[model samples]
Target: MKEQNNTTLMTTTENYEDYKDTTFDYEHYEELCVKHDIRRFAEVFLPVFYSVAFILGVAGNSLVVAIYAYYKKMRTKTDVYLLNLAVADLLLLFTLPFWAVDASIGWKLGNAMCKITAALYTINFSSGMQFLACISLDRFFAVTKASSQQNFKKRCWAICIFVWTTSLMLSITDLYFSEVKEHNGKHACLPIYPKDSVKEVTALIQILEIVFCFVIPFLIMLFCYTAMAKVLLKTPNIKRSRSLKVLLTVVGVFLITQFPYNVTKLWRALDIIYGLITRCETSRTIDLMMQVTGSMALFHCCLNPLLYAYMGTTFKTYITKTVKRFSSWRKQRTESVEEYTMYSESHVEETSSFSI
Candidate 1:
């Protein structure tokens, strides 16, 4: 019995030693799992999409800013909001190139630039959405309660200030938590909240962003545009159909561009909080969807000027007049140059004849 007990003890000890030697290989396990090649997709897709968006967005928003500044066209509260919206769109567009590079080749711009760029992106994105809401509200008031014009006009600057301040405050998270980190042997610039609170903080920020940037603005636009559409329908004006179409286009475009992106963002936030995405393929699909949806959302900046132009009679008229004036100025300058050349040639000929 003693001999049997000693043999059993020796077998148990050997089994324990074997188990200790067979350590779990996390990296090898990860390797065995099917890797999602997101970097390849991002490298091919993001730079081209971002480039087009940046070029068109810059050109359109710059023209909007130039027309507003040159013509002094902030004649209404809606105009003020449109101008600020244009400015915010331009600022947001400015951050795309950095992101494009980051997506393609990784973030080489250092930690400070990462933070600044991230913060700027958040600020302008938030403010742009808010300004869209402001514009809708202003137009709603204009159509429904003309008597409220004086109050809105008086508060336009104040409201803009509030939007910008609110956007800035919301971006504090990016400014504080953004950093450059290596992922899969490539550097990325992203917010890395404290490990203890990362899930909670990320989820909270994502929810806040979706609410303020997308949900609230969408609700305001929906309400204001619906009311304005009803008012236009009842007014029996010549431009009523056109106005209704513009309102529909605005709301339609917003929904098409923003809705999917926000949905994906919300999903990501929920996943962070709940560890919802367990499969590697599902995670990769979500990443791809996020990239595609995000690019679509950014494309809205390019459409803003076009949407505003359709919506605003004043903007259309100003754009037409500006084009005509620019053409006339160029023609007159060309004619003047030709006349000066002729005069100089004639003078030279006279001087030569006199010398002869």
Candidate 2:
């Protein structure tokens, strides 16, 4: 039930798409009729999809980083998690152009690049989801536990360190296992997992991925937001409507886009562990569904800054101020350059007249 190594985050940018790059050898994979259609679709659709994602993801995530770095004097506890989330999004998009090229063409890049790109893709994907958990937990404490501002500030860095360390260790598993293998004269970047190994390491890793990426974060968000909504309703000064809106939107988008991909992965993992794959059509359907859902997950990253960060009035103000300041600076620089050119021309004329 393993897919092509690098076609997607869940599938690791996997198999069907690679079939497109290998012309004469397509029949071998064509035996899996559903997969054959998936491969064809991947060739046409994934390249375009990944390209759009790369552009929007980089632009939106970069703006998030900019607002935090240049616009804000000091970041709050929530801001710390949000900033790391942006970094993870940036990292995820960095590997996308490479995958886009692979989907459009093939893994023309060699094994080293295969390892690098796959590892980066896996790392960021895993870490970004983990940060969502951190965000939820931080909010939960802010609402329920009622820590002092100083205590919360101190906890932010410590919690950040712990979560990032754990996620990096989780990510490094891909770095160790990811490899480039030749398939029908084409190269692919994917994890090296044996289906029937005695150790069952591949299945174990897959389960871990579901747990770390989808399960824990989802539970944390659900519980925290539920409690947060309750607390906000009780508070007299704070407007509950806006906070509730943002909370619901954040949770809704993630679950809708993320559930399918992770659930598909979970299904595949079980199929591999128990040998339950009875029909190629069913498997192929899962493949198509996974590809589409995974793209939605990527889209979620693009929306992170908007859904979580920009939903705040304070954050919107900072973004506005930064844009205005940048525009003014650019205008001033243009005027200064024009003035210098005018002065140089007049000085040249005066000097020429004196010489004559």
Per-model TM-score on C-alpha atoms: 0.83, 0.84
lDDT score at residue 126, model 2, on the 0-100 scale:
75
In the range 199-261, model 1's lDDT, one tens digit per residue, is 689789889989999999999999999999888889979988888888999999999999988
Please name the candidate that would achieve the greatest lDDT relative to the true structure. Answer: 1
Q: What's model 2's overall lDDT?
A: 0.72
lDDT (Cα, 0-100) at 251 in candidate 1: 97
Global lDDT of model 1: 0.75
Q: Score candidate 1 by TM-score against the native.
A: 0.83
Clashing pairs in 2: 4-14, 4-15, 5-12, 5-190, 6-12, 6-13, 7-12, 7-13, 7-14, 8-13
Q: Note the Cα lDDT for every prediction shown.
A: 0.75, 0.72
Worst 10 residues of 2 by lDDT: 12-21
